[model samples]
Target: MAEQWWRRPVLVDAALAVAVAAAVAIAIQVAGEPIERQADFLAYALGGLMGAVLLLRRRWPLAVLFATVAILLTYYSLDYPGLAPAVPLSAALFSAAVAGRFRWAILVAAAVVVGGLVARVIEFDMATLPVASAVITDAALLVSIVLLGETLRSRRERVEAEADRRVADERLRIAREMHDGLGQTIAAVNVQAGLADDVLDKNPVRAREALQVIRQSTKEALQELKTMLTVLREGSETRQPGIDQLDELLDVARKAGLRVTSMTSGEPRPMSAEVDRTVYRIVQEAVTNTIRHANATTVTVELCYAPDSLIIEVTDNGTNTQQGNTSGFGLTGMAERVSALDGRLAADFLPDGGFRVRAELRT
Candidate 1:
């Protein structure tokens, strides 16, 4: 208990102030001063009392300032050199300023300087220099300290905001990938299963084939989902989704219902995972939109690979309900995803009643 109590700043400051006061008292005694003088004893007692009260500066800054001011006034009035308690006074001022009450600190600082000046002028002493210097130095130091604290706080806030933005961006990208990849595959499976169910009694062999395709499509989707999710949930930040299985993805769409015709141009080559994933995603979304929104039922997906870029296009005959409450969020999400990858995406409604989506990803 004793060790912990002494470790506290308030307790340590109080102890030091008391020690200085005692030293001052001893000096006065050694100067052959009359100890029996009532005024002299009273001054020494007031110094010790004021120093003790200063221990509570952090807990009660205003009270500490009030007590220190009173002590200074009493000492100056009585001309008691042994009662000079500048240490406690400075500590009280610093504590108030650090407590984030700058206006109050300024008011107290002004009052101290003015009162000290008035007292010194009355006493006709050279002590005014020390008092004035102490007041100015303490105020300046306190102001700088507070300003530094605020600056660091602002910097921390900015760093936190940047971190939040990065996280949000990553999450949005993940959602877009999941939607473009898993969403399309799942939708195809649903369509194939529904068709098989309707045709099972009339055409057993065709229905069995459709069911097989559905099973294979869903299994592939599961594998792709696992791979993408693993990259997202763990490993290095450089990990990305790529299109290593484009043929299988397209086959699933073909089996669903839409007569999808796909053609690849230029020399096929390996590309960056991010770019590959983006190509697959754009095609997947385009195909899904064709299935869900088109009426004429014929869809074509073309991938024109050039030396520097890959061009993707999906066009379908429009016959579905175009004016219905459709979730256009998928289109909006696709645009955001493509832009992040430095790609361009465009969607158009044909005057002849068809829809088309074109995307170009630069290498």
Candidate 2:
């Protein structure tokens, strides 16, 4: 898609150039002293040139500032007009400051003010031009213009930084969603595929059941993926799996060959969407890890609700070969999710012979 015509940089610069040129030319004609007929055209030419130099300000701000200052100084040196020093130089100073050249803009403004005041003292009598008053007024006006430009630059930078932060946050949310949603489904599918391969000829009925589980797991995974994509593409909220879906989640694990059971001991109450999603992800990750790494036949998921907190624990009676390697992405993501809600997570080996994951989330 094309950028709006007014928003295009080239078009904006062209408009600014025309405005500056007109302002400079009008300032000269309105305030300039009478000069020779031919010299008036030269004066106007110099003013237009000052404005024209601004067209390149974005690319070479310092150069443009210097060029505009040189043109203004030349116009005044020829005794063309007694225009205000801040008027013609304001645009250039602003451009330089906005381009992050604040020091250069300040130095140029100071030099112009000092040089112009000294020139006026030398050319006109001190009585004719109130030298001190003129110097004070001109210096204040130029400083204000530079300050304005610097303020705009700072504001623009802050806005850009906030935008970048939001983009990063959105990306991280999407990643966590993908990991939680698809990781469990893929692990179940892997287990079912292995079972089907092992019993393909020897136990045709078992193999068929395993294949059916694989088909269902894949279908669920595809549906979850499509839902996530829809949320990303349309910027709409989709129903995320929560504690209410635990039954279906456990059933899937059972179909994949793991005898999974869940028990809730707390008085179930409504939770915020974020907390609900986090709780589901915690259990989902725990189960997937049990299926993949903890070679266990039976798994138990427990949910205990207290007055101010919700506690979840998943334990499996399996030979967890990867017990020491609990720092995988799944656990790390789970820990982050728990930590985000000011909660705590513990993943350690049980005393007897299994692995356990426990999380406590504050309501």
Q: Pick the candidate with the highest TM-score.
A: 2
For model 2, how does the per-residue alpha-carbon lDDT over 1-363 read when each residue is reduced to its tens digit? 988979888888788888878877777667744562333788888877877887898999999999888887787667677554465589889889999999999998899788867776886667644888888887888888889999999999999999999999898888888988888889999998998999999999999998888998999999989989988888737677788988887877787688888888969899888889889999988898888888899999999999999999999998966853855578888889999999999998988999999999999
Model 1 per-residue lDDT tens digits across residues 93-170: 666665555567667666666665665566546575776776577556545544554455467678989999989988
- Model 2 TM-score is 0.92
Model 1 TM-score, all chains together: 0.64
Candidate 2, residue 125: lDDT:
61
| Stretches > 4 Å off in candidate 1 | 1-133, 236-239, 264-273, 305-310, 321-325
TM-score of each: 0.64, 0.92
Summed backbone clashes in each candidate are 1, 0
The lDDT of model 1 is 0.70
